[model samples]
Target chain A: MRNRTLTTITVVLAAGALALSACSSSKKNTNGGGLGGGSSANNGGTNQTYKIGFVGALSGPNAQLGINERNGATLAIDQANASGKYKFKIALNAQDSEGDPAKAPAAATALISDPTVVAVIGPAFSGESKAVNPSFCQASPPMPTVTASASNAELQNQGNKCWHRIIPNDNVEGSQGADWLARTGAKKVYVLSDLSAYGAGVAGTMAKELKAKGVSVVSSGVDGTTTKNYNPIAGTIAASGTDALFYGGYDAQSALLAKALVAAGYKGRTVTGNGGKSSVFTTGAGKAGNGWYFTCGCQDATIAPTAKEFTAAYTAKFNTPPSTYSPEAFDAANLLMDAISKASASGTATRTSVLDALNKEDFTGITTQIKFQANGEVQSSSLIVNLFQEKSGAIKGLGNIKELN
Target chain B: MSQSENWVQQLPQNIIIGLEQGSVYSLIALGYTLVYGVLQLINFAHSEVFMAGGFGSYLVVNGIVGHRHMTGVMVPLTVLCGVLSGALTGAAIAWLLEKVAYKTLRRSGAPKLAFLISAIGASLFLSNLAGKLFNRLPNNAFPTYFDINHQLFKIGNAKVTLIEVIIVGSAVVMMIFLDRLVNRTKLGRGIRAVAEDAPTAALMGIDIDKTISRTFVIGGALAGAAGFMFGTAFGVSNLMGFTPGVKAFAAAVLGGIGNIRGAMIGGLILGQAEVLIAALPFVGAQWNDVISFVVLVLILLVRPTGILGERLGRAA
Candidate 1:
């Protein structure tokens, strides 16, 4: 009886293990196939389709920004498809990276392996883009990637020919932000960065620019994740009597700092880089976010004119207005399709041919005129600087603030 | 100026910020220590329980309150709901883990190593489960309810807000209450008895299984409270639990795995250390995690058995 019972237990355990493995494997296959399947659909000659993959955080804490990018990309693709200028249908394979550096490579790898993918769109945040950029280096006819939101200088400095981005790097954004602070007649600026590559790089760059403009960088540093209360730091900033504060980080910490700074009686204006430009900051900080300024690559209102029809189509499809990155994603899709059409016109749609076409192409996007320099940084005329208002809980885009010549 | 004045003047503001932030870490650490006191297994998924509490409160506040502006009893009530949800989830997770993983192994006389492995698996499974269910996005935000921007008080040159007061005060109160319960209550005796010797306690008519379950529930409740506090303090996200979980675990180990008081002490020390490290003039803020792990390693090196040393018969 004991021997039979042992066998039964063993069999039950094995079955359970098998079931768990099967379920997990199936989920992985679905995501993997979802990314690669777009490429396969494009392979059929009569119904030639081009797939572009956009990887970013679509549903996490950073969902607002990622969703916007996704929406922008989708709108652009829809317009391109409607124009009937391309022989193939433009399909986007979007996967969420959850804003994690570790998961970005896997997502990028999956997208790059797809044979029919002409170009890649994003990994959203700079940290994720930097994490995944190394993988594109080894791909045959290297994957041409256009980061929709990545701004860290390290991404451009990666020395990889395949990496390209439409957004201004942190150097430009940081310089502009510092200049804004200086314009406010702030003699001393207190700076805080998140300590991530994106945060530190931007903060460091801003400090350099602030010093160059003869403004004192009174104090600068990072806040640890374990540290929750920001009042003490805000108190210190107020006590230092710095004229303004510049935070180079994402919305979560920025919101907390904004609240704390206001509570601590810092009357000066506050500025943050692109990562901090989100509705979350205004919402989380509430009325304290009033008069806060932020700089990003594109303003939603500027894109609104070119994107009105796209927005209407997106609302018709997704039943809501596209989030911030959607227009960029839409533009990316169009850029890819434009390149693909040019490449396919020569009989075969080779990756090299597609890349060559992408290199020479100049497409006007909602955000900027998308043209890449040798290093793949978009050669744009200006970056958007916006003032976030607590009442509207939205960024009032102040158009493109031209770069200082 | 005097040398002392000069030193004070030169001390970086960022370091002060780091220390203030450490206060939250201390609160989360208390929960980990309390649970480990009786049930020696590290409550690996406690962080997720805290995350659930935050999200739960966000849902309630966003869905029910409907008003953009929050005030009066609404903030406290929302926090309470958040705490309750977190506690309930933690309790459920602890009970399920015992029933599915630990209980069977204990009954079969499996080695302790097996239980450790199972616990790790459970932690990974829970984290991934949450990731899959929620779209693996790390940037979700807790719905803003209370506006914490108003200054509540100012000390000399420093200003403090109601939010800071709430976070620091509540954490302290909870810690004291937990200490009193463990030291003075009959339930606490039962917990001590079980921790001392489960087989002997059972022989003395102390329901071992029930005590363990109760211990888990209490720990879960504490973790839930921590989660609610975290959401209110720092905001919420799916992966928000990860760093806190690791830190809380570090605090537990720092305090001594089965020593309740040790966890409390360890947590405060770790929190303060992390903040101070981040605030250091040269180090700045980005070294927060780097500082935390460094302190953890130092603690382990200096006192491998932790501040309190492991309790006998508590290796569940």
Candidate 2:
């Protein structure tokens, strides 16, 4: 009886594990996909309505970036439909990849199988981009993906040809950030990351470049699963007595670290990769965020000339200013829509026609003129550095926002 | 300043940071352990109670501060309002969870698994409701009214900050108060009697339901208070309670599920381990959580009743 009961327990446990794994590996049913300024809706009707698939994190720690992308896409779609440019209505079919690579394959498969989905706007972060690449490239008459801000170079190294990101790769962010650090003349630097693929990628590259530039670097990783106390990392950074501290992580932890660092009385200038450039970082860190500089390739209303109207429209629509990469997200959507437009102008725009159109396009976007190279990289992608400061006791750009050439 | 200069020198500061964090964990853990003590059922919805407290705090803070900095009187007043609202909200939500979610299961004499499933459903319902009401993204923009991070004192390389002092201070006061209430008060005796022998306590005219409800309120209030302290340090979000909830559960199990004092020690130990393990050069912070569960497993293997829990006959 005992042996039989043991077997039964094992079977039950195995089934439970399998069920959990199956559930965790998929998560694509989330169609409302935008948690920030994203209108919650179901599938666009099966008739007369063309669908654009948005595959990124719609609900997680990384949801802010994805929502920014979704809002941009939604904004673009709303504009095109309103303009009566296309005879048919375009609807967004946004899926949550949870910003995780494991779930990306299922989302990719779901997007590829949808007959109405002519093109996709994103798999926002670099790791998710890499996860979806092979599946997207391997699809028959491969679908094109235009990403606003997935900066990892490995996504391009896969030679998927189906992936085109307007933003510069991690190499650009790392080298550009290293240049700024070097320019500040900080010989000894302390670096830290949340240890995510994106976080580690940017931090590792920055550290390597900083070392090559004859700077001494002390680096560490913090637990990013959830926002725990960041005081230890802040303490280590302060105790190190580094001239400056550079972080390669998201805004939430950056805010906490900045708060702790300020409390610890660390006088060094705090800088971060693209992860820290968002308004979320500034708001999250509050007063302690003052005088901290961060670098990003993502276009925001505050920085881009092309984004002024979009920002105004976005603020009017969402009642809040768009975050770091919304403009790039808008540009990316425009690029994809442009391809769809090019394809639709011909008889029928299948996934193949969209893919073909994506390769040969020289589309000009507000953030930058979108042009793709052979390896799906932008021709000359760049990064901008901005500092957070106190203006009228509110944490914002204090004086003039300086652009690092 | 390089990595070569002994990392061990910073251990004291790391420990202090860990204790502050652990204090927050202990606050949340008290709720889970307290509910378990009386009902003998895990209340998964308790995390939602904690999250509710955060939203309560966010609303109060939003009303009081509204994106502007305040000096002197406004700071303490704002914190007081936020914490009180948060505590009250947490208490109300805990009472509701008992009434709406678990009370039926208890009355029906249903199996424990049924209660667990219902608790989980309630947890998801509350989380999604919060997500829908508030934006799903991290609502971290609220200004901290009390901006006290100045150095309080120093021990070796570790400097104590005012924020840490407040966090540790509030947590210890609450824990001590609850411990005294559980051990000394008339209601405390009733709760202990119910925990010790529910049927017997009921026969003795001790109101089991009332005692259980009171226990939940106390736990919920402490958790809500902790939420305000935690939100002040880390920002609040709809999903904020989850990780701390899980860690606090681990802390409870490590401390012996029904033992209040054990939960406190467990939270502190877990917090210290999370930091110290991460402090080790190559293993890093990622391994800290893994070490936490491992420690729990080792403790269970060595002493199934936990450090403070007694023999089977003396379980209470």
Q: In terms of lDDT, which candidate is strongest?
A: 2
lDDT of 1 by residue, B1-316 (tens): 4423433653444333443455556656665665566556666656766666556555655675666666789777776676566556656666676666566665666655665656555555665565555544343445666664445765554445566666667767777887787778987788888778767888989987788777766776676666666766666666677787788778778877777777767777787776555544566545666776788889789988887777633654
Error (Å) of candidate 2 at residue A302 is 4.3
Give the alpha-carbon lDDT of every model: 0.68, 0.76
Off by over 4 Å in 1: A1-45, A223-233, A302-316, A380-391, A403-405, B1-27, B56-89, B128-160, B293-304, B308-316
For candidate 2, lDDT tens digit of each residue in A75-189?
8878876776765667788888878898888888888999888888888887778778778888887888888878775777887878888887777778767877787799889
Best by TM-score: 2
Q: Native-vs-model 1 lDDT?
A: 0.68
**Every model's DockQ:** 0.34, 0.22
Per candidate, the number of residue pairs that clash is 28, 0
Among incorrect, acceptable, medium and high, the docking class of model 2 is: incorrect
Evaluated on chain B only, what are the TM-scores of all the candidate structures, in order?
0.85, 0.94
lDDT value, candidate 2, whole model: 0.76
